[model samples]
Structure formats: C-alpha cells, structure tokens
Target: MSEQIETWGDLVERAGVGIGGTPSDAPVTKLISAPIPITGSDGTKDFGGCGSGCGCMPQA
Candidate 1:
C-alpha cells in the first residue's frame, strides 16, 4: 500500500519514520551565530561563504 504525506504531522505518524526517536522539546534556535573565517587570499574575499553570491545562501 502506498501513502502520501501532505504535512509534517502525517509523516511523523507513520511507522519506521523514526519520529518518536526525535525530541519534541528540542530548542528552536540551535544555529551557531559565529562567522566562519575563510583562509587563503585567492582574491575570493567577496564571496560571502553562505550568503549573497554563494549558492548556500538563502534566496530572497
């Protein structure tokens, strides 16, 4: 039998999905606020690691 999941709750209810193993009360904000320094002066200082021109950055 095949089933479609439309929401996070639906996916969590399914078995073998490892939903119960995850902590429900985990902190919402676990991201590190520190800026990662990029070494090597290859004239790549303008390339913002994970922002702007970088593909890792979130697009507005």
Candidate 2:
C-alpha cells in the first residue's frame, strides 16, 4: 500500500497535477456559507446523485 502511494506521488509530481488536481496547497478560509439552512425537504426530485433516490422516498 505504501509503495502504491509512493508511485502515485511520483506521477502527480511529474505531471504537475497535485492531489485531486488542486492548483496548489493553500489555506482557504470561508467567511460566509449557506444563509438558509435545510430544515426539511421532500427530496422527491431525483438529481441523479444516487442510483435511485435520496432514500427518503421509496424507489419505483
């Protein structure tokens, strides 16, 4: 497992593509976030995020 991780690190370094394709390692701080928090949702609309549905609703 360590060997595989080392190989991946070498490629990522050569390709200049950091882990997850992130531009560079920088400390990011979020000041603001979602204003209205989700209290409840029917979640009937399927966004294709899951194979079937959000699990709150039964699958057809």
Per-model TM-score, in order, reads: 0.23, 0.23
Off by over 4 Å in 2: 1-6, 21-60
Cα deviation of 42, candidate 1, in Å: 18
Angstrom error at residue 36, model 2: 46
The sequence of per-residue lDDT tens digits that candidate 2 reaches over residues 1-60 is 223323544556656875675434433343243333323456534433333434433334
- Provide the overall lDDT of each model, using Cα atoms, as 2-decimal numbers: 0.47, 0.43
Q: Could you give candidate 1's per-residue lDDT for residues 1-60 as a string of tens digits?
A: 346555444555554465565554433332343344443257664544555655344334
TM-score of 1: 0.23
Q: Can you list the residue pairs that collide in candidate 1?
A: none
